[model samples]
Target: MNERRTAVPPLIVTQDNSFFFEGAAAGRLLIQRCADCGTLRHPPGPTCPQCRSFEWDTVESSRRGTLHSWTISHHPQDPAFEYPLAVGLLDLEEGTRLVADIAGVPHDELHIGMPLEVGFAEHAHGAVLPQLRAPGASRTEEGES
Candidate 1:
């Protein structure tokens, strides 16, 4: 995978959330899918909120999403993050919305309904992340209508 320059720290993954990180390492964006109701959920968990079932699994995302909302931080919260950091929400095609750092687009230009794609940024400690980017940044739409 190509190196995506980023300064944020690697995300911590535990027994409950290893699937997301593992998928990131393998260069795929993964989200939680309800084994019973077939609904997708982000920030993966043990129970399906839709079906109230304890059964769940991972689904590799379409890696395509639309920018829903955002707030750029002019104040530096962490030196690891660049000034004007864009922390935003994306509504994925699979019906799940996730919060992640939006990259490859000027912070000031971000707005609602902007097309986006995923890029994997490898952390210094070796964990990978699913960072957001513009749709035209060499990403192909696969199996997504």
Candidate 2:
């Protein structure tokens, strides 16, 4: 048995963002919302910067967003990742921005306002990661790479 195993990136779960990971495993994109002021925050924190409120709750995101910004990495920071990786900040319709790896789109085709959707990338170590994918980016032209 010479099965090759790929390494999965580690996920740091804390009390603040545990719900985000749990939602990822369940194929949902969750965001932290301030219960008091109804303000939404990403990279979940204990206090809302807007309202400075400790009271918070979770909300399932629409999983749809526009590419706010992006950078294509020709260099792989880790051996587990591939080169020329595309990363983008998704501006969710919920009025929050999410930074995640963008997939299923060619490097040259990426635009600042391009639409993307959330998807879960299953890891070999049983971790599910949230990633972005092009909504309708299939090649229909003949001989298109």
Best candidate, TM-score: 2
lDDT of each: 0.77, 0.81
* Global CA lDDT computed for model 2: 0.81
Off by over 4 Å in 2: 1-9, 123-126, 136-145
Cα lDDT tens digits, model 2, 4-59, are: 35555467789998899899988789999999999999889999999899999999
**TM-score for all models, in order of appearance:** 0.81, 0.83
**Tens digits of lDDT, candidate 1, 36-137:** 888788788878878888888888888898999988888746554566788878888888887778877897689899888777765545677777888866
The CA lDDT at 98 in model 1 is: 78
C-alpha RMSD by candidate, in order: 4.8, 5.4
